[model samples]
Target: MADEGTSTKPVRPSMGSMRSSSFLQDHQQYRPPNKPENHYGIDTVVEDIQASQISSPRQISPFNGIPSSENPPKIVESGVTHEFSHPNCTPAPGSRTDRLVATLFYRSSAPRISNAIPSPQRVPSPPRAPHSPKISALDADIPPTMAPSSSLETFPLEPPSSEPEPLDHLYGSHISPMCITSFLHLMSTFPLPPNSPSPTSAHRCLKLSAAHENHPEVVELTLSPAPSADYLSLADLRKHELIYRFEQEWNVDVALRADTLWRRYPRLVVFDMDSTLITQEVIDLLAATITDPPDLAARVADITHRAMLGELEFDSAFRERVKLLTGLSGEIFTQLRQVLEVTNGVRPLLRALKKLGVKTAVLSGGFLPLTSWLAGELGIDYAHANEVVIDEATGRLTGEVKGRIVGKERKKELLLEIAEKEGIDLQQVVAVGDGANDLLMMEAAGLGVAWNAKPRVQMEAGARLNGESLLDLLHLFGFTEEEIQQLVA
Candidate 1:
């Protein structure tokens, strides 16, 4: 009894793995009609399959150790193989099954160049296809002649033969480059300077002559002078073989002429005023100077965008936008007219246009006061724009537009009017503008451009020029690098 005070109970082991005695006692919960205990039967499945059929390299569980009964692996023929566990995943018929099977067939079917005894040399075809019999007959056709196999051994050493061949015997079904070159050399007697502004004149004549010779479809040809040769006609030439090279020579000469003509031709140039000819949007600038309500500029801008994209009727959109600024004073127009900055390329492009006699004009939907001011500043011959109305009593904006709004249709009218007045065809006119209202005018011109236009405007325009400088406009007329540089200089 002396140590009884410190007596303690012994620690007990855990019984958490076993079911409670109460679980076995509750017969109704275990075997109730509505609720019953479930068994997965995983152990029963393992017991039914044969031991040898099972593959159990690693034990999965202590009490229910089992293995899967899948078939053993086998070697497949050469080709790609993709095995799937699902029966529905099999490949379709004719699909390569194994990599080895595919690789072997691929290598067997591949073409190989052999180095065994060399084969006899095959005759090369002439570069051109034969012309139709009727076409050849019309040109006083020359039959194709084959150069001897041995004769080709020394190229460039053979001197050029100078004899005109009948038009029909050229290499390709198309006009021969050789013939073009020869024809140009023959026509070199004409005053076509290599430095000529344009050879289109010479090209037209060559094209006409080629048409008469029965080669009717000659559109483009590039020619270079061949080794110097005496020019001789088909009847007078001693060497008949040179006729084989004549077609290609003719193509060369005609090409040179076409290029010369294209170069000499005059070009039509156009300009877009907002951020193109001029640095700022005239409408927005007008709005800002007039101190319009904040919402007024945004609404005008939205309508302007819709009009430019063709989403809204230009007249309606223009009227609606102008209505928003109904109370703005007219004096702001005078102020904007003074502060406007001509964009980088305006002066140069105008000078170049004037120097080249390019019909130059300003097509704007902005106010006429500013348009006229700019037209005079750059020396442009024509300017078209809307007219802002002012109340005589107040000298402030009557908040109304006067005359034609110069919306899309009006712009189109102005373009046609200018073109007609100048006695120039629509094809000779170029229209440039940034607004949606300018689209119709641009469309009527030979080249209609969206200059730094909104996204909606660019897609409708013939071309979109967003460059920082305007000289790039020269490129549209097909000016060469040298010519552009000379003009800029």
Candidate 2:
């Protein structure tokens, strides 16, 4: 089959040829060290045929008759042997050559053929993009510096600034009628404004005035003209609004000022005695004094509730309830007085008010006997209420009211009278109550406080206290805890 002048002697093979030949022979007879019982040697005939094919490239495959020299074997670490053709050789599906190649490399532990030839030293992969830690949805809007720390040692601390930073300019301020604890905490983050009005100069602005001993609740300060000049941004405003609007646990209310809170301090404080100063409604307790009549107490209580809710006219309700108590002995007032409960925080509140020279008056729609007694007990300066008529002969209730019914209109008139008598301006008076009857007086005062009042009263009140104590009212007036403690001490 040789052509004339063509050399029949085999061409000298390269080093790769010698190594692949030896490896093939060694692998043909090889058995795994762990399984010496198995033998995987190829038959002599097949070995001879494969060697001839390797020697002569033309005899490798019959389909395309490709030369073996063009397509060499590449050994990869994955235990799969790949045959690389000159351009490329794609074995046809189900072909005899494809099956033969598959059988030759079936899960064999043979050494990689590429190891025989030196490969270019591996070039390391480029460093991956710096990892970005994911943030929680709730904290996505928070600054990275403010994010929660996993460990105390890893927490970042701010380095001291080389230069002193200017104070945050005053934008606007709001005083919550509730507790000052949260408000004080919020203010700790920002420094007090510079060149801001002082207590003495605050009175000059007429919009805001300095906090004084008389009006500890008043905080009057000037704001920068430009909103953007202040450290409190619009977002911070929104946050403050949310905090104020949803604060329910504390009983204080809030008042906002764009410029100042320049107003005279309250010189007089008029209280609705029944429920404002005292926890019990005097009329309800009086009715409860009728022990002999089971249904009488319940009936009087219903009328009292309706009148406070504005469902019934106070005068008519008072008369109806008083009529039910006609047969009761006058001694019942003594029993009722023994069980009267004072509103929480009233003692401290009164003491604070008294020290500030704020006069107090109790305008009650209940009986005068109890109102006057409560006034003396609480050290209140003035007391006014409707009188319950008592028969001198029997020493028992006459089932009638004496003097004018101290209804809603009368209460308002009394408030004006008291202010005038005290020689104080109407604007310098504070009124606190919980019923429809007291609304007129409440409206007449400079500061109207609805103390755990009906919904209607609360809606109209300047400040509403729905919390545990009357002490929060002191906070609204701008009294700090230190000042309060000093006063108490």
What are the runs in model 1 whose C-alpha is more than 4 Å off?
Answer: 1-272, 290-292
| Cα lDDT tens digits for candidate 2, 174-273 | 2222224344343344433455321111111111113333322233222222133266643244235443432322212433222213233568999998
- TM-score for candidate 2: 0.51
* lDDT to native, each model: 0.52, 0.61
Model 2 root mean square deviation, Cα atoms: 35.5
Q: In model 2, where do residues sit more than 4 Å from their true spots?
A: 1-252, 255-264
Enumerate residue pairs that collide in model 2: 177-252, 177-253, 178-252, 178-253, 207-262, 216-477, 216-478, 217-477, 217-478, 218-477
Q: All predictions: root-mean-square deviation over Cα?
A: 31.5, 35.5
The number of clashing residue pairs in each candidate reads: 46, 10
Error of 2 at 368 (Å): 0.6
116-233: candidate 1 lDDT, tens digit per residue: 2111244433343332223222222122232323445633454434344334333433344444454545444433323322222122112212233544223332322211233432
Candidate with best lDDT: 2
